[model samples]
Every structure is written in structure tokens, then in C-alpha cells.
Target: MSKALRRTFVAATSLLALLAGASPALPTQGTFLAPIAEHHHDSSLMYGTSSNWSGYAATGGKFTSVSAEWVQPTVTCTKTDTWSAFWIGLDGDGSRTVEQIGTEADCSGGTPVYGSWYEMYPAYPAYFNNAVHPGDHFTASVTTTGNGVFNLTLRNVTRNWSRSIAKSLKSATLASAEVIAEAPSSSTGVLPLADFGTVGFTNAKVNGKSLGASNPSVIDMATKDGVTKATTSGITDGTAFSVTWKHS
Candidate 1:
């Protein structure tokens, strides 16, 4: 298979696992941090009305799984002048839930990057969050662990874009990145539980012959599940999750 095809396959398979409530174990080679809540002051900047949530399962004090994916679009003026952007959200509603706090960005002069995370909270209504920033070339992941109201964690990854731009591009790079919510945070924030809801993505792409114009889809709660597992797909490749929560 071609490189693009391979990437699509891998991304799709990974997203499937997340939606099924079955997440793989973390890598032991790389150092990892315990899950923590990362809150953002700018919540309204990413808010919208057309958002939906999915992948709800029950986990009693044990670790439940969630994941997201999406594709991002890159604008190329010259082979040497190019840029891209993508975003996603992490949220939940209840007395305590998981929330996304921040993200990291990575990129290449010509290629893309990846990002991921694992978040944890002590209360419900975590709020909508993203794993990456706009105009970045990166991919991300998230995970969480804990019991009832305590002992939750979050992990994140953000791909950074390069400053160099290829001059005289042969083809336009328009695509959707994948965003996954591997683990929900356990928090007491009001945003996670509000009626407004949350959103995420999996992939986005543009044809070499056509202009790319697509917006990232939102993920929100359809049914209230007590500590349920959910998944979001169809996002810009390399984008992560961000957050904007309201206190009610």
C-alpha cells in the first residue's frame, strides 16, 4: 500500500479499538507522566452547536477506554510556503469527569506529526477540550485511570509544524486528521456536564486538483452513562484535543 493509504489504515484501526472500549497498553520505553487535569481559560473560542458524542460503556472503578481521530488541512502557497490547523475536545457530564487541559504541536517541513493524551478528573462536567493547536502538523492520544472520585490521570501528545515551506508544490495537501479520547478525566468542572456538549474529529483531506474546505465535527453526549466509554473520529490527522469549560 502507498504511504497515505498505510496511514489511513493505521489511523482507522486505532480508532476502531478506541470506539470498542479496548485500548492498548502504554509503551514502556518512553517515560510517561501520571494523568492530571489541564484547564484552559479560553473555552468559548472552540465552542459550537453542532457536536455529538459516541462510544458509551460502563466501567466500575476499573479503567475504561476512549479514543478520537481526525485529519487536518494544509495550505501551500509555494513549495516553501505552507501551513495547517486542526482541533478536538475532551469532556464529560456528571458529578465528576475527565477534562483536557493543554496540548503540544509538532510538524515537519513537508510531512505531518502525531499527538495523544490521557486525562483524569475528580468530579463531573469536565468540559470540551482539544489535543492540539491550529496551524500545527501533529497527531495526539489520551488515556486515564482511577476509582470513583479520585486517582485519575491524563496523557497527551502534540505534533509541531516546521517553519520551512516547500516551494512549487506539485500537489495540494488537503486531508482530515484523527482525534481520539482514550480515557476520560474525572473532574468536578461544570463545562463537562452542561447541556451545550463537546466535540472531536478523525480525518480531513483535500484533492490535488480541488480546494479543501471542511470544518472539524463536534462530539457530544447523546445518552448519560455513569463512567461510560466514548469515541470520536473523522478529524485532521495530527491534531489534538483542546478545552473550554463553563462553571455552573
Candidate 2:
């Protein structure tokens, strides 16, 4: 071939090779970063309202009253690309009391069991101060997982309340709010289940979210917006409850 023809052929081949390298690669299955799962629960009878309780246990002591509220969303994902956060709203009557508001990744085993959980004390006086009371409002967040589950549980433990007090309290009412993200786990790469649950209180309502049984990639206890605390009051019990996972 002539020198000019040879040069043109070489240039064409080089351009083709460059194009091949520059082309975007196809996204692999399970390789894409899924959106953070979101869920919310709200009270149907009352707008942001719930029941309460007070009690005592052999281990804790001096139990008073306990109330709670929560929300669960309907989104699913294997893991989050970013960190997860939770938000909540709280209120009550009587003296300013300390409330323990927390989120857990795996709670299928029950409370105080330490089954891969993350928690936060949103009350005004820290656990160290030991001075929290009713009518308190605050927000909390938990990024760590107990074992590696994507489950989130919000429990409002009173400073002086135990399982006994949780049972005797009357005229108890309260509200709980929550939010979560699709953030990646620090301990492991897998995300926790999106299912969630709450203890104490009556007439609970979960809003701004949906169920996860229909989604294949999403897990239970995964919330995105955290909890909200508005129009809440009263108390009934101190028992623990949860939104159990149902995979089809």
C-alpha cells in the first residue's frame, strides 16, 4: 500500500481502539448503588399520638412511666452507599424525665438482648446527669449495627422506670417519630433489615413509608426519615413491640 494509505489505515485502527476503551462499561447485576430504604408509621386514630406505661424489673429498679410511637417505610436495598441516620419527636406530662430513644439493626431476638442494635438517649439530661422527665422533645441518630442486621428499633426507656412501672401506669399516651438512610454499614458491607418495632404506648401510627415484603432487594427495619414527635401524650404499658419481617 502507498505511504499515505498506510498512515490512514493506522490512524483508523488507533481511533477504533480509543473508542473501545472510552466506552462506558455496562452496570453489573447487584453492582449498582441502591437508594436508601425509607419507611414511616403514624397513629390512625390520633395524629402523632400513642399510649404509655410505667413499671419495674428485677434488674433495672425504680420504674416510673413509659410511652412510645414510631413509623416504618416501604423501601428495600442490600446496602447503602452513604451513612444512615434517624430522627424522632417526643413529648409528655409531669416532671422533665429522661427518655432512651434508640434504633437497632437486628431486634428479632427481643429487647435488652443486645442482638446487633444501635441506640441513642435523646432526653435533655444525658444518662450520666440522671435528670430527665416528661414533656421532653428531642432527635437521635445511630450509625453502628449490633451484629450486621439492617433492623431499626426505637425504645423509650425512662430513667426511673422498669417493667413493673411500665405495667401499672394509667392514662398514658405518647407519640414517636423516626427516619433512616441507606448508608453503608461500618462493621460489614451488607445492610440491615428494614423492619422496625416499638415498645409501650397504644394506638400507634406509621406514616410516610411502605412495606418491604414485595421488594426483593430491600431489607426490613430500614427507615429513611427518622421519627417525628408531634401531638403525643399519655401512657399504658412498658412492654416491647416490633414490626416483624414477612418475606414472601
Once fitted onto the true fold, the runs of candidate 1 whose alpha carbons sit more than 4 angstroms away are 1-63, 71-91, 101-133, 145-200, 203-248
Q: What is the lDDT of residue 83 in candidate 2?
A: 18
Q: Tell me the number of clashing residue pairs for each predicted model.
A: 138, 92
Q: What overall lDDT, based on C-alpha atoms, would model 1 receive against the true structure?
A: 0.24
- The 10-residue segment of model 2 with minimum total lDDT is 7-16
Candidate 1 positional error at 31, Å = 31
Q: Which candidate is the best by TM-score?
A: 1
What does candidate 1 score in Cα RMSD to the true structure? 19.3
- Per-model TM-score, in order, reads 0.24, 0.21
Question: Model 1 reaches what TM-score against the true structure?
Answer: 0.24
Candidate 1 per-residue C-alpha lDDT over 193-222 given as tens digits, one digit per residue, 9 for 90 to 100: 221123334332211111012232333222
Evaluate residue 192 in candidate 1 and report its C-alpha lDDT on the 0 to 100 scale. Answer: 23
The lDDT of each candidate is 0.24, 0.21
